[model samples]
Target: MNAQAPHRQRKSWIIWSLVTMGLALFVGANAHLAYVAFASQPDCVSHSKGSGEAHDYRAAKSAC
Candidate 1:
């Protein structure tokens, strides 16, 4: 019984360590994605003309 205590404690420590590492990785990846989204600027391309047709859709506002 006493010998099992150390083994169980070691296993619990390993599980908690893995969980912490996984959370850190998740947060780091999201932070990197957010940084890229904010840091990069993409040029806008022209779209098809609306021509006031029902099928055609126009942007509410143009960025270019």
Candidate 2:
């Protein structure tokens, strides 16, 4: 009925909005997952007693 048309359309819009948000979130979270946790390729060799090369500097390394 015409009286309920607006409500249906509003509900559809909300559903679409939520779907879009979820899709964006999923894509954003997975987009770079393959590059996470795994160490990056070492640029140069490191051979200190307890030294190692920087592996994808996600954070600063402290001196050991």
Candidate 3:
């Protein structure tokens, strides 16, 4: 079987290389998800109107 040893080794190397690549992709995706979960901020707008005791305030997409 010595004649086929090199071919078998090459196939094993290719499989391991693909497994490593898949692991790296999974890690990168999780890192991106964590970053977005922690680092994202809301973009919002607000408005306020007042006339003495008739004061009013409001914010878009949220309660003010």
Candidate number achieving the greatest lDDT relative to the actual structure: 1
- lDDT by residue for model 1 (1-64), tens: 5989999999999999999999999999999999999999988878755788778876778788
Model 2 C-alpha lDDT per residue in residues 1-64, reported as the tens digit of each score? 5899999999999999999999999998886775674645555544344435554332345333
**Ranked by TM-score, top first:** 1, 3, 2
**Model 1, which residues run further than 4 Å from truth?**
none
List RMSD in Å for every model shown. Answer: 1.8, 8.0, 7.7
Q: What is the C-alpha lDDT of each candidate?
A: 0.90, 0.70, 0.80
Look at candidate 2 and tell me the lDDT of residue 51.
Answer: 39
Query: What TM-score fits each model?
Result: 0.81, 0.53, 0.64
Candidate 2 ranges with C-alpha deviation above 4 Å? 37-64
The worst-scoring run of ten residues by lDDT in candidate 2 lies at: 55-64
Q: What is the RMSD, in Å, between candidate 2 and the native fold over all Cα?
A: 8.0
Pick the winner on lDDT between candidates 1 and 3.
1
Lowest summed-lDDT stretch of 10 residues in model 3? 55-64
Judge candidate 2 at residue 26 and give its lDDT. 93
- lDDT of the structure predicted as candidate 2: 0.70
Cα misplacement distance, residue 32 of candidate 3 (Å)? 0.6
